[model samples]
Target: MAKNTVIGFLGSTLDASKRDSSRWQKWRPTIGLCMQQDLRVDRLILLHGEKHESLARFITQDIASVSPETSVEPHRINFDDAWDFEEVYTELLDFAQGFPFDPEHEDYLVHITTGTHVAQICLFLLTEARFIPGKLLQTQPRRGQPDPSGSWNAIDLDLSRYDSIAQRFAASSRESTSFLKGGIETRNAAFNTIIDEIEQVATRSSAPLLLMGPTGAGKSLLARRIYELKAEKHQLSGPFVEVNCATLKGDNAMSALFGHRKGAFTGAVADRAGLLRSADGGMLFLDEIGELGLDEQAMILRAIEEKRFLPMGSDKEASSKFQLIAGTNLNLIDAVASGAFRDDLFARLNLWTFHLPGLADRKEDIEPNIDYELERYAAAEDTRVTFNKEARERYLAFATGPNAIWSGNFRDLSASITRMATLSPDGRIDRKTVDMEVARLQRLWTSDRGDDDDTQLSAILGAERLTRIDPFDRAQLSEVVKVCRHSASLSAAGRDLFAVSRQSRSSTNDADRLRKYLMKFGLSFDEVRAR
Candidate 1:
C-alpha cells in the first residue's frame, strides 16, 4: 500500500489573506494542513467554485511554496447554489466518482473544513458510503490559542459511538418484539414487560424458563422466539428441539424423552436418541409439560438438574448439557395438590415463569396485527393483498368488538387473513370480503365456545339471576359482561356498548342506565368488572 492523499474542496476566498508573509500566521486551514509533519498529503485535489477560480490558483501556489513535496491540483465546478444541499451533493458526488483513483497505490481523505455546511455533509456522505474511499479531516479555529496554525483532526465515519445508532438499535429491539408476537405490538404493559425481561434472561442466562398461558395464547411461539434470540447472540450452539409432553404417554413418553435402546420396547429395532439428546448444547422446549407422567417427570427432573439421564433398557447414563424452556396451560400448583405432577420438577422449572395474556386482553393491538397479517399473507403467497379503507375499518370494528372472542389468538388472526387474501379478487379485499370473513369467524368462535364458559358465568352471577333472564337475553348480556370486564369503568363499557342508544337518550345518563340493566340481573358493575 502507498501513502494516502488529501482530497479537499478549496476555501480559496477564506484562505486568501493579504496581511501575512509567513502564511502560517493567518491560521487558514489549507495552510494549516501544510504545517502538519505527521500527515503526508502527497497529492491534494482542490475543488473550487466558478467564482473562486483565481483565488484557487493563489491558494494552490501558496500550498506548493510552503510544502515543496506536496502536489496541488485545482478543479473548478459550476454550482447553481452552494447552500442548496441537493446541488452541492450532486456536484461533489459526480466529481468524486469521475476522479482518477488508485486504491492499491494511494489512500484519500476528504477535508470537511473548507466548504459550506452543505458541502461538508456531502463530502462526509460520499466518504462514508465508500463512494470516496477515505476518512474526513476537520480543522478547528485557534481562537487566540498559542498554536497560530489552528489544530486539525481526522474523523472516521464509524457511527457506532453515536446516540443515533443506539436509537436505531432500540428500534430494532422493538421490531424483534413485534416479530416474536407475529407482528403485533401488544399494548398490554404486563406483556411488554415480560418480553423485555425474557429478552434479558434469554441473552444472559440459561436457566429454565416456564411459560404459562391458555392454549393458543402464543406460549409455543414465544418459546421459539427465545431460542432464536439466544441463537442470534451465540448463546446456544445446537439446534432447538421442541416436543409436546401431552402427546407422550406410558412407555412412549420415556422412549421419546429419554431415548431407548434396541429391544427396550415391543417395536424397538434400533437405539433411539430422544429429544433430550437432540437438544444437547442447545434448548429444549417442552410444551404442555404438565401432561408428562410421574415416571418421566422424575427422569426429566434429573436431566434438568444434573444434565444426565439414563437411556431406557441401559444402565449407562448419557449426559446432554442443554437449556430447558417449559410451557404449560395447566396450573402446576393444582397439579401438585392432586399428585398429578412431581413437586420437585415443578420447583426446578418454576424459577422463571411468564404468563402470556389471551388475544382478548390486548384488543388495542388488533389493528396493527391486522396489517401485519396482510403483509404475512402476501409474503407466503407471493401475491400482494390489500384491504380497502372502508373494508379495513369494518374488519377492525368487528375484530375489536365484544363479539370477537379470538379463541385461537394469533393462530385465528393468521387464518382469517389467509381466507380473506385467498377470496379477494385481484389482490384487493373489499367490503363484501370483509363481511364474509367476519361472519365466518363468528361462526367458528360460536362453535368453539363450549358449555364451560356458561357454567363459569352461571357460577359467577348465580343460577337465580341466570334463570330470570331468557337465554337470548343471557347471550346478549354475556357480551356486555365481557365488555365491562375489559373496560376501565362502567361508564366506558356503557359508552362502547350503547353508543347509538346513548345518542338517542335525551338524558345522557349512560352509566346509570347501564347500572340499572345489570341490577335487573342481580349483578353490579363492580362485581362484573372484578370478574
Candidate 2:
C-alpha cells in the first residue's frame, strides 16, 4: 500500500493557543487533520514563511508526541505579502516545481484548511490543474466532541464525478457554442463542430486565430462573436477594432494599421492610435488579411509576436498588446507559394486555422440560416416578415437546387431574403412573392456569371487586343462567347444570341449570323467554348 503524505501550511492562529495546556484541549485544524482515526499520515509537508518557523517547529514537535508514526517535514515557502495573490501563487508554483512528488508510491493530500485565503485559493488551483499531485484534505472542528481532532474529508478534483457541476459546465459550453454560431441552430455537424472548437479556444487562449473562408462566409461575424464572448468572460476590456486590409494602400496602409506620429506624411496633422493600439487589451479583427501589402504583413507579424511596432515616421517603437483574429478568403498557402504572403507570418497564424465552409457546401444549414436572416431583417427594419409554408418550401427548393450556385455564399442568401422580406405585400411571403424572388435570384446569378466574360474574353484576345476593340463590339462579343460556352452547338448558340432578331425574319438562318459575328472577332464557336 502507498504511504499517505499530507501537505499544507502551519496555521498561525488555528495551531497556536493562549496557554500550553489549552493547546491540547482546543481543536487545531492542522493537528486534527493528521490525527484522524482512519487516515494514516506517514509524512506531513508543512509549508510556512520565515516568521512562522518557530510555530512550524512547535507544531512538528507536538505532532511527533501524538502521532509518532507521522514524520513532519518543514518546507519554508516565503510570501512577500501573505494576502497578495500573485506573490502567493508565484511562490507556490515555484515550490510545486521543485517539490519531489512521488504519487505512484505515496498518496498525497493538500491540507487547504490551514493556509491564508490567498494561499488556499492558490493551492486549490495548483491541485486542480495538477501542478500538485494531490487531493484536497479539509478538516473541520467539532463543537462539543471529546476528541480535539475534528472530522476530515478528502475532495476529489475530477469534477466529472459531480453530476450537477458537470451538467452546469456542459450547459455553459452549449450556450457558448450557440453564441459563437450567432444563435442559429445550424444543422451542419461539421460547422457546429468547428464552432464548438473555436469557442473552447477563444475562451481558453489569447493566441492569434486565422479564419479562412470564401467571401460572405461569416468570418467577420464569427470574429465579432468571439470578441463578445471573451468580453462576457471579462477577458477583454478594450473595444473591438476591425479593418478590411484590402482598402489599405501605399503610405496610407502603414499609417492606418500602425498609427502615424504628427507630420509623418502630408495628410498627417496629428497623432493617431492605430487599430492595433485601439484594440489593446481586446480583439482586432483584420478582415481580408490576405490583401495586406507585404510591408504591412511584416509589421503585422512583428506586432503579433512582440506586441511592439514602430509607427510611421516615428523615432520610438510603440506597444499594443491585443488578440488578433485574421480573416482571409484567399488561399494563403497559394499566396505564400506565389511570394505574395510571408511564410513566417503564415506559420504564426497557422497555429489555429479554421476553414469555414461556403453556403453551397453547407446547404443543409440554409433553412435555419434563412430563419436567422429573416429575424435579423425584422429587427433591423422593425417589420416582422415571414414566408408561408409553400413559399418557404419553394425558396428552399431553389436555394438548394443545382442551378442556384451561391457564389457569394451567405451574402447572396441574405440579399435574397432581404429583397423578399422588403417586397412582402402582407408582411407574409406567398408563393407569388417566392416566384418573383426565385426569378430575381436566377437573373442575379446569371448576370454575375455573365459579367465574368470580360476576364474570359481578355484572356483569349489578350488585354491589349480587347482594349483596341470598340466598347460595343467587346461587350457584344463577350455575350457571344458566353452563349457559345453554354450551348451544345453553333446553331443553338445563334438561336440564343439572336432569339429576338430571328423572330422578325420570315426565314433566317441563326447559325449564319453567329458564324459571321464570330469571324469578325477572328474566333470560332469551338475556340470560344474550349477557352
- In terms of lDDT, which candidate is strongest? 2
Model 1 TM-score, all chains together? 0.56
Error of 2 at 239 (Å): 0.6
Tens digit of per-residue lDDT, candidate 1, span 360-402: 8888877777788888887887898998999988888787866
> Where does candidate 2 stray beyond 4 Å?
1-3, 18-20, 37-42, 48-61, 64-105, 116-121, 143-147, 451-531
lDDT tens per residue, model 2, 1-531: 999999899998899876577777889888887788999999999998899888888888889888999999999888779999999999999999999999999999999998899999999999999999989999988767766799999999999999999999999999999999989999999998999899999999999999999999999999999999999999999889999999999888898899999999998999988888888888999999999989999999999999999999899999998999999999999999999999999999999999999999998999999999999999999999999998998788877766566888999999989999989857998888877777666556646777576567766775434544665776778777878989999999989888998899999899988998889888888888887
